[model samples]
Target chain A: MIHFDQVSKRYQSGHEALRNVSFRLAAGEMAFLTGHSGAGKTTLLRLVALVERASRGQVLIGGQNLNRLAHRKIPYFRRNIGLVFQDHRLLPERTVFDNVALPLVIAGARHQEIARRVRAALDKVGLLGKERLHPLTLSGGEQQRVGIARAVVNKPPILLADEPTGNLDPELSREIMGLFGSFSNFGVTVLIATHDIELIQRMNTRTLVLSKGCLVDD
Target chain B: MRAKATTPHFERGPRFQLRAWLLRHLQTLFSALGELTRSPLGTAMTAGVIGIALALPAGLYVFLDNVQAVGQNWDGKVEISLFLKDQIDDEAASRFALSLHKRSELRHVQLITRAEALEEYRQLSGFAEALNAFEQENPLPALVLVEPTLRYAQPEAIKGLVAELGRLPAVELAQFDLEWLQRLHAIIHTLKRGVVVLAALLALGVLLIVGNTIRLGIENRRAEIEIIQLVGATDAFIRRPFLYTGFCFGLLGALMAWLLVEGGLWLVRGPLAELASLYQANFLLASLGLRASLVLCLMGALLGLAGSWLAVRRHLRGIEVG
Candidate 1:
């Protein structure tokens, strides 16, 4: 579950990213956050990632207040949250398997467990046969799938994807959205931040829309 | 497919946790080693700097050790020379010389009365006819020649002996040195201090060299590091490989320095031996013993580890998950 209570974020340059935004998602629920380019969706997600602190907030994930988390605890707190970037930030030099297994390696997983989890993740993304290939050799959709596999490799309880389908074709975007649907089916809460209203309409899921530093509709 | 249906919660026992801990460290250690081997030239250059820095001090210490050893073996340079007062008669000086023969330090004590002293002085001064003019009274004092055993002939020990003899009622002045021995000791002391200072400065230089290298390495890997930090890698996890790289550099540098110092001493030993032979000495060059080489290697590795630690502590904060 994620909760943002009266959260506001203002950059040091006097630009307000978010203003008094409050939201709550029940445990095991999935939803989409829709907003314009500068509507502060990324800032909200960044607050969840603990990458940036809110100017005034009580952002809570699983009932733990992230605003009160120490800097030293940030990494461990991230262990439970899976993040997928818009550009598929997989290390280009690494093989698909290494890219996926990175989180487990950081967690000091046993080699056998790492192999099993990584293979399972690759299989889920339908890239099991391309584990040895580098990320650059893959198509954009495939590269993003690799990124998804990496995000889910650790089986993090919460998944946050920022514009997961931004660079894909319509069919590929549908496929990627379908991947989120699959995870949501089993009670893994997923929050996808995107502005594509058609995709949101096609998925028929809960949507929270932001406009001009405020939540305009839900 | 339901995600939790196919995936049971991944949990581990304590034993598995321990094994994971061990394997992770081994992987990082080998990975760091691989990074260095990927660029042989760069690693060699860094290690070479450390090697030269370490060798300067180690070689100086080895050289100084040999100098003192050789100096210790020079026994025949000088011995105790006791000058009796002019008031002492020939019989009294002879009695004192006989008493000196009872001491273990004095190997041979020769007594020369005033008559014998004047006669030797007449020959050496080339005043035989002028000496005949001093028939009224011989102005030369009685002399005692005391040859000390080799064991007690060290400058410090001889000085102690000279002090003891000067307190004698009949002795006027005590001579225990070749005069050059005191000056030689002062020079050796000064050189020892110089070597210590040089070693300290070189050690500091080694730290800076290693620390700078690690800092550059951190900068070069900035992107990878940010990615690592993003994916829940702790700072310690990210720093592990760099620390190992520094340690490897230090270790290899120490080995190279040992080879350099030993080879250098080997080259000089031939010439040094001949020179010592010319002086009728049985001196051979000294090399770093196994214990000393082990110490050098340990010190090199520690310096490397310390340098990397310092660099990481200072720069890791600047590289937050930006």
Candidate 2:
């Protein structure tokens, strides 16, 4: 569903963050993006998310070239793509239900549908009872689960996770990865960027590795 | 299958209605409002600052308005006084008054004969016995009290007419009681300019107050905003809550200022009424009227909105989501 054709990104400080990186993920595919610290993994995902424009190459999502899309239209494009961070990124002041329902809210879903979908998403992540609780009240693993629930709540076709398990212990990381794997089985395209080699081996997913601002392996 | 059927129907309805877009984003707006309400003390403090800043100029404005209303009543009392030569008799003064009555500039003219003037002066001065002791004659001149037409009541026009009357053979001197009016007009004009400058300076103060508040709010929410952006939230979406916070502060401030000004007016109303009674006048201190109040509210809102917009536009650009 996403294609990066030799995409390159450069900062104004003369640092080339991504140099001629190219990759493609088929529809409903699950993949892991492995890279060390200061690697171009985040930049690659950001390009697909259309947060940063490729300096000299095309980044395509769902057959639309993101580099050519108008800035005002970016939000509309983002409505179909879900992003999760290592920190979970749930609004600290809001309840789990509200955070999970945010994307649907942004998409202008009906209130009843939002309630229903948020409940179902929370249920799927084993957070059904914590709907009204704030993120700070939840454990790190539970918070990440809430993040995952939020990411998939809008039923976005593509889900991107950057270091979703970085802050978790081995057991919690396994649980989060299993949750992602379950989402893939539901036909949601999943791409996770992580540095955990052991976890990557256990997941048995397609792996793309990057080093020093360049994609070294796929 | 039921879920699929419901989904398409739900999806179709939103596609046709533009209001759905706003309704869909209501959560974001409500979330923003919730954040503002979360810290009631901080919110109240910021709003109080805005209110004080706005009330200073608004109170001065009301004062200027009251002054103008009182001044308007006295504008009609302006008139010119013609003093005839000491040798000029009552008959000549009466003829001169009659001549002046024919002029378009003269609204009404009354001839005060020298003997009648001396008799009135004796009555007013409590000098009846002293005047009788003088024996020969009172040296007071025959006077003409001339009320000018409203159109010719202005200082320049009255001055021109007075100069013309001064040149008349029977006239010794001509004076208009416009000196006080002229002084009042000059003072009001200067006060208006001063109020404008003061309002401008106070407006800047309000901007800075609101700007600083928003800046602090942004700093507090910096991490959350970075995370929001990382999760594909646009700058507009991230900035929405702060803008709403600023607007709320401004709106609350306006309400407080309105109360402050009204309270001040109420406190002084009784004394002002007594002062008016002393002058034997029915003067009412004017309050901030509907239009002025509306303007004040709108100004407060704009100040808040503009201040937040500036703060967000400047600061948000520097934040990069990792």
| lDDT of each residue in B222-247, candidate 2, tens digit only | 88787666545666777878887777
lDDT of 1 by residue, B251-320 (tens): 9889989988999999999998899877667788989999989999999998988888888888887997
Judge candidate 2 at residue A111 and give its lDDT: 77
Show the colliding residue pairs in model 1.
Answer: none
- What is the TM-score of each predicted model, taking all chains together? 0.84, 0.83
Off by over 4 Å in 2: A8-20, A55-57, A211-217, B1-17, B21-34, B81-104, B109-145, B163-175
Model number 2 iRMSD: 5.5
Which tens-of-lDDT digit does each residue in A77-127 have in candidate 2? Answer: 776777988878888978999889877765556778899999999999999
Candidate 2: the clashing residue pairs are none
Taken over the whole model, the C-alpha lDDT of each candidate is 0.86, 0.82
Worst 10 residues of 2 chain A by lDDT: A102-111
Deviation (Å) of B303 in candidate 2: 1.5
